[model samples]
Target: MATAIRRLLTAAVLLAAAAAAPARAGTLPPLVDVAWLEARLGDPALLILDVRGPLDGEDVVPFERAHIPGSVHTDYLKDGWRTTVEGVPFVLPPVDRLEVLLGDLGIDETRTVVVVPYGSTSTGFGTAARVYWTLRVLGHDAVTILDGGFLTWRADPARPVETGPSVPEPALFEAKPRLDWVVDTREVERALRDDAALLVDARPEDQYAGRTVKPGVQAAGHIPGALNLPESVFFVPGSGRLKPVRELAALVPGTVRGFAGPIITYCNTGHWAATLWFVMHELLGMEDVRLYDASMVGWAADPKRPVERAVPASG
Candidate 1:
């Protein structure tokens, strides 16, 4: 073969290989039952992470003093997964920095991470969902939330508990940003106007209405015509689990009626948004759900957008 022809053939082979390979899409692992996790506790590929933090200024370390054995401690607050960009709260760190941090935490491409938050459910436990969001956006396909979080783990006396940190060998996990997992202000603005997508605001009634909002929001109300199912509703105190799937299915607006358009879940700074996304993507089995990582912090920063809230939304 001619030299030029040989080079062309090589280039074609490379192109074909690239096209034929799987696109490396992310996977949303289900919320595991206690039995499921207990069964998998001894799996070599699994790592349990505790994401509990101080509640109402109480020291979190004390709680960690008695926690599930074989669990690694990770503080979503002080560990520096976020930074303040123009005062938008807790923005995700750059991919390179995140990759290093995950490695230090003993998480890697091959690990199946299970994160447990401070609470059994969503009472001030948005941090767990936030960390879950971080893992998902970083192209991890094997992350699961410990069903009902730490509270459930605590309730069962037989479940093993230990004090302090559990360390592991530093790992080498490479995280490529999956931008599709997240939506930005532009996409949100379009979702607000578009007839297809649903924009679910996970903020409280006060924030949703014009009563009170966190600082720096452009306007006091919700995105022009967004649905309001504040994150709190999803947390059922009785079960320690998220609301029953049937209850949630009926509660979630767009899912029941065959309206499976894209969902963009958002809250003040994306923390609560993660909870909403978790409920939809994991519990309710809603498809094509995405998070606005910047969330209201980015949306409300702009003057062009309109916030409108009048009626209280219910099931």
Candidate 2:
């Protein structure tokens, strides 16, 4: 009972902090625009994580040069947040490892984490979504993604940017895995047999059609019976912003009805699929969504698994 009460009190305090944040009216959503983030730059409960890519395994010079004030830098590519298991790349690390990682970054259950990416393209934005998904899978509910990310932040010269490393006092991070949000190869195979879930392919059209293939996977085609909604469709190129919810929903296939049904999203290594999961669950408010974390790499590892490519009508 004491633990329950403490949790309730912590929740209340976080809620009050959010309510008092300088954000624009209507409250913050899972995706916050630059304007919204700019307004809440000093909220004590807010933690901005700038996950810029470390090109060619080099140092994070871009983050070292400038970042949002009070933000911390973590190289998404270099970080062990995603790892390989049995040759499958980009799989989530174990719970203890994630706890140490998040704790070292000064994250805790009480804080509201806003993941920031470079926002150069869908690929960059996917970094934010993948991190956001990781936090969610670890049961961190008070997380959001910075729409337009650091690119949008820098576009506004007036917004303050800071240089030099900012060391934060570490916090105790507790990992509470939400297994329902994750699925594996066996579960996906069962879903295919039972027709119990809508499988959404987050790969590009050519990839989904097996015309283009990514390395590290045995098969080029997508899982049989999956719907195609390439992750790139969610972003406007060169704009650094995701499409509005109405626009995103319009892109959904007409065959799929209702947001409550189970939907499993997958890409080559779960990187792209994280973007789709964020769009459907976080932005669209869809429920019963899960990510195939192993994605195509794991699915295609076995020779027995089936892959299907939609053949364009012969011209």
Predictions in order: lDDT: 0.72, 0.81
Candidate 2 global lDDT: 0.81
* Lowest lDDT block of 10, candidate 2: 17-26
RMSD of each: 12.0, 9.8
Over 4 Å off in model 1, which ranges? 1-29, 55-63, 120-123, 193-196, 215-218, 238-240, 254-257, 312-315
lDDT of 1 at 171: 96
Evaluate model 1: give its lDDT. 0.72
- Runs in model 2 deviating more than 4 A are 1-27, 54-61, 312-315
lDDT of 2 by residue, 29-142 (tens): 788888888888899999999987742124233877898999987777776888887777788888899898999899998789999987777787888898999998998878
